[model samples]
Target: MSEPGSSVAAVVVAAGRGIRIGGGMPKQYRRVGGQAVLTRTLDALGGDPVIGRIQVVIAADAAAFFETCRAELSPAVADKLLPPVEGGATRQDSVRAGLEALAAAGAPDVVLVHDAARPFVDSELIARAVAAGRDHGAAVPGVAVADTIKLVEDRDAIGRVRETPARENLRAVQTPQAFAFGLLRAAHRAAAEEGLHAFTDDGALAEWAGHAVVVFAGDLRNRKITQPADLIEADRAFAGPSATGSGAETAKDIAMTTYVTRLGTGFDVHAFTEGDHVWLGGVKIPADRGVLAHSDGDVALHALTDALLGAIADGDIGTHFPPSDEQWRGASSDRFLAHACTLVRARGGRIDHLDITVLAEAPRIGAHREAIRARIAEICAVPLTAVSIKATTTEKLGFVGRAEGLAAQAAATVRLPEDAEADPVDAQAETAMRQG
Candidate 1:
């Protein structure tokens, strides 16, 4: 598009409250197609070879939500993210903040301003935006309007049509609106000085700043999630045939029907040591003592990680992150679980469910079940409903009963492509485990 490598950066505006979607949280944070809208948006942009970096603008109160969302992304994609900046009151302010952040970090050749709600923006569309921006200085993707257009006046309960515009001349604009890094930055800076912050999109702001904004072709399927119905429609698109209707072909009915369901189990234990808290299932819990291990000693996450690896016939947590490795000593176990999930996804597999049971007489899990369930779901990139947590005691029979140690057993269910090959490194470990 703009030569082979033209140094592109993107600013994803996700600060909006998105109340129209009616979710308890912001619409961008809500899950559609089993993933957050913002996560999908980041993945789409980060997956592109041409884009070098990304900056996200979020509400000040959304840091925790954003972190959970970020945890769901692949490591490669997550690596492209910049520390998120807090947004302002209006969309214009939020965009300006993002642009300023990008500029401060050394501006790129071209900058793309995208909406986090539009998760369907593909690499081709991004490439087109870059090319058009380089050629025209400013360009926005627009789809030609198909319906009749009308101007309305609101003088009564129902607005009346005052004028009709020609259908051929009407176009609906969408984003990943592109511009020369210098040109857009100057426009935003000038607008801030002049108190001109009413513009809804960067394209409009550039046009207001006397820059001729060209319109390139836009995709119809690249719809934004502004309403609840829009979210539902997008969810159904990714959720597959069952989400659509009964008449749709099931997975078995389709060709290349090699997908199969499998289950794996794992158990882990850690002796209590001198500490004030314990990390379980990626959540820290106040306790009389902590577990003795090389890592954070998160027995729940350790067992779950092993379970996921076992599901795909891969290596256990220890096999992947050996305690002997100095780098893994005192490391967070969440990383191990996340790595396991990534391995499952690499082989074209999807986790169906994860269940964990903890055997501990002290630090009862009843009070922290929901939090643990949520953290695991976030790490696995699965719905909360798909995770189950339970706890029990050995009734003074063994180490767990005597409160000397905590143990956890986990089960993982996953669907994988039958043709997926076993990872050679993990295969050796699996064989060793069998033999031992």
Candidate 2:
């Protein structure tokens, strides 16, 4: 385990061909939400303040494709990114190669090993992994298993269920699995020395090496893009706010069925409280007083979250995260916005744009406008060019004018598949897919 201020790095394994996805290029090279899957994964890791450096493992012949995707990343991510390392034939081999590279370049105290195909990872998950890794030598993120799992015997034409595992004790694990850099490196070396290359994940390898690994809470939206339809869904979720907007370039690849455009608007208000700063659009801005609310009181993000939910006919933020829920007392509003975005994508919808207006007389937003826009863009997994944030005062006429509180209004535009408009048609499609 590492110390309080230990250095942290990440290794993104992107070398696999991903044949099941059926794209001419590797699945990591596929575009999702206007960005390459690998690029998005890198951004998600690099954007977090806890992670210091990132190294990517790519196929030997994919340098050109990797560079093309690399060029499109946010400047901040590019700065933390290291030169790509050549990966091996298997996922295990790729991770070992990455670890070796980091060891050669001065190993960090902790290393987060992640798959390039899962691009929806967020800062909260990363923070949890880091903390768990620090406390334990190894850690992985997991969600509770919602469905009964069967142990099957596949010796015959049709597999037979041997036993059913209790769902309460089961967990579905995902990565950016975290580990103490030295422990993981040593485990990989030991496994290689023993000719053990079949371990599915680093956590398993560590467990085999006799290290205790813990599982932390994971985000549901951190799904892997393993199939063709997953790519389509990710693309829709990341689509720009307009056909001619940032995601226009990839629209042709995503629109596989009839779609309908939708618009949703939301408004929120928060009174002033005694504090030094306030949160806005996921960016913490210096202010004379903070806003009073259940969450961090990010008016801009709350309105945007509600707007996104509205676009998909989902309930408002209050319905999803009630004010009475103590669990959400100081929750970050970005989580709320991301959840809303996930709901939109789950229904095969694409976000076209998000426009927000902030009303306040004190703690002017003029200086933080671009920062706010960038933060919103990151949270929504959209391009900064696609998010619009504007601020104006109430002209000293109302509560905002008298500096009593801050208010924000937001509008969201989205495009959803036609089947989403009719429940029966969507249900029919689901049934047909299952039968086929």
Candidate 3:
């Protein structure tokens, strides 16, 4: 493949032979779900839209192993991966070798340095890192330390525990640390010239090279798979009974977050156009004229119906109940709102709350607000406190002031829970997958 700019390239460090896991093969080639771990790592990087090409580094003898592993890759990613290059004995040395390959291939504006051990990096983090490199020349994805840390001195004899490090000043670093092509190249070249190889990670190399590295919030989902247990947890995270997982997990991994969506709308027009009495919030208010519409035209009911449907991802009243319906041509609209609430519950979704606002210059909606609220709540199958009916005029504007038509708007929030079951379908899928 033709070489690309540094910005478009990634040096995936897969050289480590994790002895702790005790797998005969290097941990990078260890299988997960019948696929090599490194393959999954590259899958995530290649899946990132911002990334263009990847250069994976492995121990010299591991080239043949990567070849056998390549068969496991999805067709889409197999083409993007460059041939594995031999790595140096140390992690830093392997990184330098990968960088050299990138430079020779026509370095992009920036290069991402990542350990192949982490596979859950998300698109947002990738976009942020690349954006930072474009804007600031170097950036590393990291999260702040939430626990107290301490610094100790002297081991053997007393093994004295020393001072407690200030918690406010600590941050735990993680990878896919990205850097501008020139800056990273310069850091490596400078370190080589000085015979220095002491830095633990590439971002620290930037700091030692007198470059200020920027830190951005990183997703906790991006975890390093240092042991077999980590892989099990990762599997559970991506595909498992996590829907009923703890709130702490929800707070950490936003992808697992579920949101309740709701909506409401209203329409009102005073028939004061040429009549007596008016309809407000399902009630006929004593007035010189009633609301002007083919039907009693309760603007409050229309608004509440729209809100309930919107909350549950259902269609609006206009779609379900067209004015063309001669039966509803002059029929009561309170029934429409009731039907909407039922539709919401039928889908395992519930209307948590609703509010409607009516705009009319007359009929005094203020004093009648409470009575309207109670009536609508009973009609809509919700608590009076959970539903609010309000009225306000635009200070006499448009058709509202001229008393041509009354308009109302409403909003609602609904919560839905999926009906996942232990029935045959779920059981079959689970059993088949476990058997694999």
Candidate 4:
């Protein structure tokens, strides 16, 4: 049993290919609201003061992708990140690999195994999981079944209901499944020894190993991203009124009294080149040809950044990170946008919304639209709903129609405090004259 406030660690599983989502990159690496799903997951876990360390399990071939996501992490969270380990053929295998990595690093008193796709897991949920793990040997978060479930038996494409399970006794399980580190490690090894590797969740594995797994309350917002529709719903859910609550209302009220709103528009274009990929909205899409540019060639991010700069009456992307600068030749466009956001914040301003439209003839944006929107949201540090990304073609009429280049247009809405409107130099000169 773990002592009160025992050291806590987390193992994030993110090795799945995520083919069901139908993108070139793995689903975990895909952006939601401007950040990778895995990055958000890590932020939730690492931001929790209770979690002492974190180990991520990813595909061996995804080292580069993992590093790119890691670069976007907050410094405090990045400090807690351990070197990632490679996963195996199954989820069980992957968990075992993570467990082994933790053990090698000196396992904590408790561990939480989380799904990388579930980015909405909050610190409260993480604390609950940890507390439950301390009390019980193992615990899994779960929610009451909202819909009646049927135990079905399918034969030759025919299905028959065997019986209806009691809804009261049934719970829909979720992760950050917590356990005494030693107990979970031992159970995993026992399952391996017995060749029982088919368990879908660690809770089931613990039960099979004769350990009672307790069910704790789970958050509904912590739904895992699995299909394309899930991404759409998640974007909508995050953007909905419930998510913003009084915060949006308060912002609006403040803007009405002490803030001024500004709007700016920007446009960018990039021609195709002889390469296998293109960067758009900070996501690397597998394309037949890349774009010609000094930076990572993200037309969406570039336009959005320029729009942000325009809203602030600051210079455009060229003025900030000129193409003539060799250091920024291959820089990611996320940095440019982040810098613009920083400038806005420095002026006591906030980005209210960002809308972007992409003109492309190939590499359908439909598949990567949500990811792009999510990426922009993350970069802007705004809600997913505040950002929008749309795609269209010229109908084979011009350059875009001929499949030669892509164009992106963006608009940024911003709010700045009344005090930010004052020029610091003027204010200083006025103060000096008065004193004199």
Measured against the true structure, the TM-scores of the candidates, in listed sequence, are 0.73, 0.56, 0.53, 0.59
Instruction: Give the top-scoring candidate (lDDT).
Output: 1
Q: Rank candidates by lDDT, best first.
A: 1, 2, 4, 3
Which is the better candidate, 2 or 3, if ranked by lDDT?
A: 2
- Tens digits of per-residue lDDT, candidate 1, 2-55, equal 466568999999999887777445889776555678987898888887888999
lDDT assessment of candidate 2:
0.84
Put down candidate 4 lDDT per residue, 259-321, tens digits, no spaces: 689998899999999999998888889999998999999999999999999988888999999
Off by over 4 Å in 1: 1-7, 14-52, 56-94, 116-128, 151-162, 186-200, 208-210, 219-259, 418-436
| Candidate 1 residue-wise lDDT at 349 | 70
Model 4: lDDT to the true structure: 0.83
Q: lDDT of all predictions, in order shown? A: 0.84, 0.84, 0.71, 0.83
Off by over 4 Å in 2: 1-4, 155-157, 240-436
Residue 39 displacement in candidate 4 (angstroms): 1.2
| Candidate 2 vs 3: which has more TM-score | 2
Q: Is candidate 1 or candidate 4 better by lDDT?
A: 1
lDDT of 2 by residue, 1-436 (tens): 2357689999999999887887445788766654578877887788788888898999886775676556666688788888899998788999999999988888999999999998878777888899988889799999998888888898677889999988988889999899999999999999999998888799999999999989899878788999998988876655534322122234454444567999999999999999999999999989888888989999999999999989888889999999999999999998899888767866757677899999988788888889888777666656556799988987799898898999999999998877677667678999999999
User: Which window of ten consecutive residues has the lowest lDDT sum in model 3?
Assistant: 239-248
**Stretches of candidate 3 above 4 Å error?**
1-6, 155-158, 238-436
lDDT of 1: 0.84
